[model samples]
Target: MTPSAIILIVLGLAAIGYVLGRQRALKTAQREGVKLHSLSGYHGQSVALFIAVPALFLLAAWLFLQPVLIESSVSGRIPQSAIPEGGARSLVMFDVRRIAEGLNQIVAGGDVSENDLADMRADVTDVRARLAEVGVALGSDVSPIVLQTAKEYRATDLTASFVRNIAVLVVALGFGAWALARIRPGLRARNISETFIKALLMGSSLVAILTTVGIVGSLLFESISFFNMYPAKEFFLSTTWNPQFRGGSELGILPLLWGTLYVSFVALALAVPLGLMIAIYLAEYAGSRLRSYAKPAIEVLAGIPTIVYGLFALITVGPFLRDWIAQPLGLGSSSSSVMTAGLVMGIMLIPFISSLSDDIINSVPQAMRDGSYGLGATKSETIKQVILPAALPGIVGAFLLAASRAIGETMIVVMGAGASAQLDLNPFEAMTTITVKIVSQLTGDTEFASPETLVAFALGLTLFVFTLGLNILALYIVRKYREQYE
Candidate 1:
């Protein structure tokens, strides 16, 4: 049975147990002529928790383990000679899995029986033609060893899936019966249900923590592999960014880092003042109807996909800057320039900063404004001296967040800021950021094990660290200033 089917079945059983448990609790209370300690719903919840939770846990654990076990078991059966030239065992395994799935499809379509599939040999039978008929195209005809390995892969996987379904049902029935038997007037059903709920909440919380750890671990592992192939110092400190698939590439980060910072600086320079002014006007000066209409309209920019923004930069913004400003100044004639990307990105960031700052500014006590007025200060003076200081930390945090967003942007940079990794001071000159190069370096016609491809991971790790640092600094500032205000 499929995992979804098993889940639905278990839930069905849990629903039945809920009805049974609730009815049983009410019967026991009425038969004993005593009041129940908890509500009937709590009794039903305790039974349902037992029926579903353990069964779901087992299903999840089995799903995670089954693939690893199957892969290990099947990998050992294929000989080293079966692996293609310049390819790892992993690549062969991918083919083996595809073949296995194709065989399953063939059986399901009644093109082959279970016995016929088991008895078939690639050398004696037209396995490739049969698989192809089912839309599983292979690059080459099936070899005997791969066919046998694929057969083994299918057998083990099917067995594991079958066992998983049976085990989940048994667990659901067993745990559910055990819980229902213990349901009585003094069973503390409410506490048991709450404890189970708390445990689920804790698991949900761990998912985020575990997810962060997994991301860091994967980046670190791939980065370590990259550093082993390329020097760490060269990657971090060198002044160029060039990757040649044929080896001896100048994989420097200085130029990319400079462009990232330059573009981000330009973006922030445009966004921060404009966004803050918009936020201040909206929060303090705009009427309620205007604020409601205007805030959502400004925030609508956030809903537009980055690719759409990229198209805008490419078609509209890039040409405008190149013709009007860059060409006139004799800076550069390229449509793709840092100034074009920065301006578009700043427009993208405006909503992020303005929304957050608006909330923070509005959160300031109105009594502070009244106190300034009582002290005979003008409106502008009150805002300049009292309100802005109180809201500064949060505003700074919003800027940092917007800066991270700008730094990580890929499409706008690619469309507006041309893919030239250079350290020029002119904003009209074509330049690129780390993210744009990371995409370009890792994409297409490259070996995964090669330094060029692995360098993407290193770039990603660096970006993650930089963004993480920004987040930490923002959190620290917010915490420190918030405590003072509170």
Candidate 2:
């Protein structure tokens, strides 16, 4: 039976349990001539919760664990010789899973008999072609060991799925019957149902917390592995960034860090002033009619995909700067440069800063502005002396948020800034950031056992730390001054 079928059956049982439980509660109350602890509806809810929650939880756990346990058992049966040279066992298992799925599909389509499929051998039959006929594309011809393992995997998975469906239904029926038997005037059904709902809410909250812990743990563990293979001091301090798959690579963070900071600095320089001006005009000076139209139009930039901005930087801005400005002035000739990426990234960040700053400026109390004006201050003076100071903390937060966005951007850097990792001071010369190298290092048929590939995790950890620091600083600034303003 399918999981969906099991779920439907469980739900049907829950519905029946609800009706019976409610009736039992009502009859007991009437017959005993006593006040019920909870409403009939609460008794019904308690029955449904008992029937559904534990069964569903068991079903979810089984679905998650079955493949993991089956894969572990099946993978253990495959000989080490079956794995290709310098290739992972995981890759072989991937192929095994694919072939198993394909065989299942072929059987389901009625193109192959179960007995015939079981008797087939990789050496005797064209396994790849047979799978392809059913729309499963294998990369290469299957070997005998892989074929046998796939069959085993398929059989094991099918048996597990059948058992899972049976177990889930049995659990649902068992819990439901017990709940119905316990239904009475003094059952306190409302308390039991409410407790289950509260536990569910807590579980929901823990999902996000657990997810964050998992990400950090994975990065930390992989980074430690990388640091063991490569010197941590050199990774952090060396100025060059180069990685060769064949070994003797210089994996450095300084060049990437410099490029990231340089581009972000250039971007913030352009975005901050312009966005602040826009925010000031919109919040303090612009007419309501103009503000309504102008604000959304400006914010439209935020909705545009970063890839679009990257393409814009690549096709238009990069060439324009290279031809008209860089070549004429002899600053640099390359189209893909720090300046190109920085400018385009700045344009992308404008809406973020402007929108946030506008809200922050608008949030400043009117009394502050009135006090400045009453003290013989002009409108501009009131804005500079009163409103700006009041909104400073939030405006700082907006700037940091824009900085974080700029630091993490990948596509814009890839398209606008050429992948040359160096410490050159020239803005027009191409350079790459940590994110770009992280992508490049992890791409293609790379082995995770090597320091070169594992370095991606180290780079990722560094980026995470840097961004986390920025967030912390933003929070600190906000908290330090927020109370004074409030």
Q: Model 2, which residues run further than 4 Å from truth? A: 111-116, 123-125, 479-486
What local lDDT does model 1 show for residue 186? Answer: 74
Which lDDT tens digits does candidate 1 get at residues 1-486?
Answer: 789999999999999999999999999999988889999889999999999999999999899999998999889888989988977999889889999999999999986799999999999998889889999998888899999999999999998899899999999999999999988887899999999999999999999999999999999999999999999999999998888879889899889999999989998999999999999999988999999999999999888888888899999999998899889989889998888899989999999999999998998899999999999999789988999999999899888889888889998898889899998999999999999988888785888888898888999999999998998898887777678656
Per lDDT, the best of the predicted structures is: 2
RMSD of each: 1.7, 2.0
User: Over the stretch 1-486, how does candidate 2's per-residue lDDT look in tens digits?
Assistant: 788888898898899888988999999999999999999999999999899999999999999899999999999999999999978899999999999999999899996799999999999999999999989899999999999999999999999998998899889989998999988899999999899899999988999999999999999999999999999999999987888878888998999999999999989999999999999999999999999999999999999999999999999999999999999999998999999999999999999999999998988888888888899999899889889888999899989989988999999999999899999899999998988888888994567789999999999999999988898888888677668754
- Which pairs clash in model 1? none
Name the TM-score of candidate 1.
Answer: 0.96
